[model samples]
Structure formats: C-alpha cells, structure tokens
Target: FRGRRGDTVKILWADADGLCLFTKRLEEGQFIWPAVRDGKVSITRSQLAMLLDKLDWRQPKTSSRNSLTML
Candidate 1:
C-alpha cells in the first residue's frame, strides 16, 4: 500500500532472532488504504483485521428491522 497501483503487498517484521519480510499479491483487484488521514503511516492490528473482513473498523454497526415498520 505504498501509494502505488498494484496487487502485491510487502510486510516487514523483526523479532529477537532476525528480520522477516513477507509479500502477498492478489490475482485481481487491489488493497486500498485510506486517503482521509491527517498524518498516519500504518494501521493497527484491529484495523487490519476489519479491513480483511470488508468492514469499516472506525465505526459501529447499527441494526434496524424493516419488517416491524411494514407490520
């Protein structure tokens, strides 16, 4: 998500032993990062999880029953 248009994503990790680098490329489509941030470099783990689930992590979900109104 280095502000480039592509499917490949690079991940860098460092542990006590050594550094690890990982990459994931989708066959189609692209992973989108938000453009509304004031100044942010990376997202939290929870945010990443929500993105992976195709949900908006920054907000709460509301449930409403339309059947009751119909009744």
Candidate 2:
C-alpha cells in the first residue's frame, strides 16, 4: 500500500500459475484512501474503477435521478 506522502507501492498476489505484481502511482495528486484503524479495508467495485482511472475514490458521486426511457 502507498503512504500518504505520495509513496509508491507494489502489491504481489498469487495467481493460478505464478505471482502477479500490481503497481500504482500518482503523478499530480495522492490517491484517496479510507480512514480505518485496522490494517485493511474493503473498497467497492465503483471505487476500484475510479482508482484505476486516477480519480479520488474516497467520495463517490451519486447517480442522478434523471433517466431516459427506452422506447
């Protein structure tokens, strides 16, 4: 996991064949993280998608009520 000071982190996971490494970094800003006293925290699918897109995943925007009806 990355630190609050814009540190780079590399995570290794066990795959079916071998180990897989995933790296993440921010060029301009730091990644939004959850405030938890525990060592680990769970993130939602939407949060993960936002993180991958280099967005702040902490505060997710709610969907608008307006919708288009399909004919």
Residue pairs clashing, model 2: none
Provide TM-scores for the models.
0.56, 0.62
| Candidate 2, residue 13: lDDT | 69
lDDT of 2 at 56: 73
Highest TM-score model number: 2
Q: What is the lDDT of residue 54 in candidate 1?
A: 47
* Best-fitting candidate, scored by lDDT: 2
Cα deviation at 54, candidate 2, in Å, is 2.8
The 0-to-1 C-alpha lDDT of every candidate, in the order given, reads 0.62, 0.68
Q: Model 2: residues >4 Å from true position, as ranges?
A: 7-9, 62-68
Count clashing residue pairs per candidate.
0, 0
